[model samples]
Target: MELTTLWFLIVGVMLIGYFVLDGFDFGVGMALPFLGKDNTDRRLIINTIGPVWDLNETWLIVAGASLFAAFPEWYATMFSGFYLALLLILVALILRGVSFEYRHQGKGEQWTRWFDQFIVWGSVVPPLLWGVAFANLVQGLPIGLLPNGGWIYEGTLLTLLNPYGLLGGVVMVLVTFTHGLVFISLKTTGDMRERARALATKVGIGAILAGAVFLVWTIVMHLDHELLWLIVTCAAIAALALIGGFVANLAGREGWAFTGNAVGIAFALLTIFSALYPYLMYSTIDPAFSMSIEGAASSQKTLELMTWVAVFTLPLVLAYQAWTYWVFRKRLTRETITAGAH
Candidate 1:
């Protein structure tokens, strides 16, 4: 494949990584109020993700940085078009990071509660906006080319609140919630695990249903593309994976259940990227105005250099992350959380 095509696939892979890894971070945070009924339960939830949440977030940094470097047009158009929404996500993320450290600083209930709200705000907003953003990317935007041979987005935030975009946000929120419940089950023991497993089973059903609607809608809307068969296959597999995840969770097989949820998310992303292949962002106004992968990508020489850098750095990053997970790999318990709390 050409360097441009290779970079496109690589970018997609990095985004999928971000969704799967940081996805649960958001999920766990969303689950906090519900699963964590009291202080101990809350502490348990926080500790479960504390060690690796920041590490998981690196996937997003990598994905965003890669996009900015590899496809400046796509980056510029999107960042500018979704400026307000992205700002909200950025603010929420910063607040969420601060909340984590601040939660420990104050020993009082009101103080901890304030920080907890920040975590929820930070976690819930981004996934919702990300879904809306990616969904809009697929559905097309009112973008036009300028006299300077650059692209400009012609719509406001209201332009992105359309039904399709809203549904995309719902799916993202639901999937992340279910994903977090599964992670909670995997990382916790005792009654906490039971609560997480049960919640995951229930929430996963809704997530799968929403995801199915989004996938099918995406397929129907883009059926004229050359990769229809691939899209259909991936969507089908994604549905099955989602169902399998629910079943595995119901059966108390947290490991398999987590794998199934992660795989389901991966396949769902595959469905989106497959339909959106070749075109980085579709044009709602005119076919000629669309931003294609080739049109959006940097030069071949830049892509080649980036590819070599990625080859050398990516493996080490993955290895270090893997080692981190291995080192922290053990089920946390309510007793452990309680012991650490005091």
Candidate 2:
């Protein structure tokens, strides 16, 4: 394969990793209000992800680095164009991380309570805004090519708030919440497990409905051909996953329920990427000015060198992640949290 193609594949894999890992993190955060009904309940939910949350976020770092290395032009354009939105996501992530660390440090219940709210906010805002930003990118933004052959974005916050963008945000939030619920169900036992299972079933159903609507809308908007088929397949898979998860939850099969949720999230992410194939950023004024993989990729030599490094490093990353998951495989319980045992 050509170096550009290799880089594309690597970036694609990194994105898939982000979806699978951070996808559940987003879900857990969204589920905070419902799953963490009490301090103990909150502890159980936190414990389920405590050991792995930071590790899960590594995919985003990889994706960003790959973008910078493999498609510097596209990176520059996107970063400048979507600066404000990206800044918001960064702030939200920082808040969420800080809250997670400091929330339990103080002895006072009130301080911890405030931090919990921050954590939930931190979790909820980023996914919603990210969905909006990406949806806007796919739909096309108002950007002009300058005399120097650079792009200039003339968009504001309102410009990013189209109906389709809002729909994307809503879909992301719902899907992530359902993902968290399924994970919580799998990683806990007793009453907390039951509650998580019930929530997962309910959210899974809601996600199906939301996903269906989004799919229909994408067709109506006349997305690109390559994206259309990929999205269609993802929608079908997501529907199946949602149904399977619901059934498993009903059957009291926690493992199956978790699997179903994971599949659903995987499919949902595939659908999004499908809708965004080729074009990383679309121009509302002129389709020809849109940024695509071919236009945005790095030099052949750069991609070739990166491919070599990827071959060796990617497996090590995967191995480390697998080991981390295995080491933290025990179920989280209320007693463990109360005793401050992770």
Candidate 3:
């Protein structure tokens, strides 16, 4: 494959990693009010993801950096166009990370509650905005090229608040919420585990419903694309995976449930990226103004150099993250939390 296409796939892989890993982290955070019945329950829930939430977040950083490096023009157009939305996501992430650290350091219960709220909002905002943002990308943006070859976004933030975009946000929220519940079920024991599993089954239905609409909308929008079949296949698999996850959760199989949801999330993303192939950013302003992958990518030499660096570093990063998860693999319990044995 050409370097430009390779980098596009690499960027897609990094994004899929972010969604698959941090997606559950987002799920766990959003689940706070639902699953956490008491301070002990809350702490147990938090501790389930405490060890690796930040680590999972690293994939976003890598994805962003890779986007900037591999497709500078695409990066520029998206960052500038989605500036306000991205800023909100950034602030939410920072607040969420801070809440994770400072919630325990509070002097009193009220202080901790404040941070807990932050954690919940922080988890909720990013995924919703991310969904809106990506949905807009698939739906096409009002972007146009300038005389100087610069790109300009002709729409405002409010323009992204359309029905389709909002539905995309809702779908993401439901998917991640269910994903987190499954994670909780996978990583906890006794009543909490069973509660999480039950909740996941309930929420997974919403995820399936909303995800079906969003994916169908996406496929319909791209019916003229040469890769329509790829998009359709991915969307079909995503729907099945989500239903399979719901069934697995019902059957008392937390591991398979989590895996199924993860696969669902991954293929949902694959459906989007597959639809978005060739054009990094589609232009609703004018089809001629859309940013193609070749038009937006960095030079061949830069891509080749970055590919070499990734070849050396990517495996090591994967190995270290795997080891970290393995080391913290034991299920958490309220008894353990009460016994101070995190």
Candidate 4:
């Protein structure tokens, strides 16, 4: 494969990793206001994700760094075009992470409650905005070529708030919320698990409707007829997986339910990245201004060197993270959470 194509897949893999890990984290955060009826309940909810939320987030950093190094032009144009939106996502991430750490530093209940609010909003905004951001990026941006061999983004924040962008935001937020509910059902036991399962059933239905709309819209707009069947196949699997997840939750098969939900989430992301193949960013203003893998890539030497570095280090990183999850694999209980709370 060409180095440019290789880096595109690598970057795509990293992004998928981020979504799989942080996707559940976002779900858990969005659930706080719903499942956490009391302080102990909230504590239980938080504890489910508390051990590894930060670690899950590192995938996003890795993905961003990879994008910056391998495809600077794509990064440059995307970041500049989505400046305000990206800033908001950054702020939300900080608040969400901080809430996990500082909400228990001998602070009062009120302080914790306030921080919980922050956590919820923090979780809420990013998925929504990310949906919007990615939608706008894929729907195409007002990017243009300069006189010199450079690119410039000529759109404002308002440009990204178009209907399709906003719909993308809503779809992601709902999807993550349901994904978290499934996770909660799996990792928690007793009343909290039951509540999570119940809520997930309801949320799952809405998620299916919203997700179906977005999935169909994506296929209709971006995919070519030759490859249409392939994307449609992925979308079908996603729909089935989501339905299975909700059904499994209702049947008290929590692990199976979580797996189904996770599979759906993965396929959903795959559909998007696959639709974006060849082109990193398509310029709405002019197709000639579109950025593709070959156009945006760094020097061949840079890619070759990075490939060697990745060959040595990436496996170790994945192994260590997998080990971390294995160590923390046991389910959380209301008793455990209450004990920690006291």
Candidate 5:
């Protein structure tokens, strides 16, 4: 209800949008070798996402910008502390974007092959690192206060490579990979659809397993949290949605499968955000050093101004993006790809 809380929720919404949308984009990129049997097949796979991948990515940009504007301290601490990891994510994204554009323009199969590899790796590194980063946030970071009233992150990159963080990364990779496969099932036809659905059913099991572990760990960590009920509820929904997705995929119901995965991913993130509600970043060193939402928020005037701007702009952006997806709603087929229809 307050401006600070409203902005926090807005930022969360933007991030959830990114992960749900671009999450599948990453999965599709990673599924390249498995689903793409030939150049044409690969093209079909790529074309399935080509129209909207860039658009999906804009959600991340909006999320980042909102963080910087609405909660500068949180953004500053996170960006500075996670500099190396964020840099890697940035490079990977750039490489993936470049590969999407240049893969077709290259002179030979070798050139395109290299870019294909880029696409796969590009899709992988960001989500893995993001999962690690968020896990560290939930697990708490070694942060201390400066004499000048600023915050300092005492831990190095290696600190983020701990068991919990690594498991988080793996879970993200598995879930997103499953999400993408389901999208492929939803967006393709004939043999491609069958193969994708079969693969999704298989991968969805791993997603369910890993996601359950991660969610249980998170819930255990937050047993004493004020929002523990919300966390538990969201986690339960996420787990069920994942299982439901697997069953839907097995039953050859692509739309429901995709929707199930999407809901699972969204609620899983909601679980995390709920757990992190009061604090922007928790301090392992001392609770006194932790950054609370109120501590991290921008001035009240700034938040109010931003709220007005969002009220005007957010719906238009949503409408345009929804229209784009609707326009590209038709399934892609081998014939469509061979006939050069994207």
Candidate 6:
């Protein structure tokens, strides 16, 4: 494959990784109130993800860096156009991270309780807004490319709040919530496990319905035919996976349930990528000024060098992640949390 194509593949993989890993993190955060009815329940839910929450976020860093290196023009345009939304996401993430650590530092329930709310809000907003941002990115925005090649956003924040964007946000929220419930089922036992399984089953069904609606609306907007087919296929697969996971969870097959949720997210992300195939950014006002993979890529030599660098470094990152998971593979329990190891 050509260097540009190779870079696209790498970036695509990175995004898939982000969706799979962080999808569950966001899911768990959303599930906190539902799965954790009391302090003990909350501790158990939190403990299930404590060891790996930070690690799961590394995929985002990799995705961002890859975009900057391989598609600098796209990055520049998107960063500038979606500056406020990105800023809000960054603040939410920071709040989530800080809350995770400091929430447990105090003995008072009020102190930790307030921070727990922050964590939930932090987790919820990012994915929802990100979906909206990506939906707008794919749907097209009012932007223009200058003679010197820099891009300008002619629309305001309200422009990103269209029906399609709202649909994307809701889909993402439901998808991530289901993803976390599956993980919680797999990583905990006893009451917490049962609660998580039941919740996962419920959220899985909701996600399937929401996803279907989003797919129909997306097609109704008259996207490219090939892209529409690809997205429809992916959406169908995701819906099927969600139903399969719900059935498996009902049957007490935790592993199968988790696998189904993972597949669901994989297909959902594929649907997003399919819809955004050639264009990184579309223009609502002028189709001629839209940015495509070819127009956004860096120089041939730069891409070639990055490909070589990715070859050596990507495996090391994967290995480290594997090691971390292996080291902390034990199921989380109330006893473990009460012992203060969390």
The TM-scores, one per candidate, come to 0.98, 0.93, 0.98, 0.95, 0.98, 0.95
lDDT to native, each model: 0.91, 0.79, 0.93, 0.85, 0.93, 0.83
Clashes of each: 0, 1, 0, 0, 0, 0
- Where is the poorest 10-residue window by lDDT in model 4? 333-342
Misplaced by over 4 Å in model 1 are 338-342
* Backbone collision tally, model 5: 0
Which regions of candidate 4 are displaced past 4 Å? 223-226, 338-342
lDDT of 6 at 30: 82
- State in Å the error of residue 184, model 3: 0.3
Tens-digit lDDT track of model 4 for 197-305? 8998888889889889888888889656456676788888888998898888889998898888888878887777777777888788899988878989999999999
Instruction: Report how far off residue 247 is in candidate 5 (Å).
Output: 1.0
Better of 3 and 6 by TM-score: 3
List, residue by residue over 142-184, the lDDT tens digit for candidate 5.
9999897778888999999999999999999999999999999
RMSD to the true structure for each prediction, in A, is 1.2, 1.9, 1.1, 1.7, 1.1, 1.7
Clashing pairs in 3: none
RMSD over all Cα atoms, model 2? 1.9
State which candidate, 1 or 2, has the greater lDDT. Answer: 1
Off by over 4 Å in 3: 338-342
Whose TM-score is higher: candidate 4's or candidate 5's? 5
User: Which pairs clash (backbone N, Cα, C closer than 3 Å) in model 5?
Assistant: none
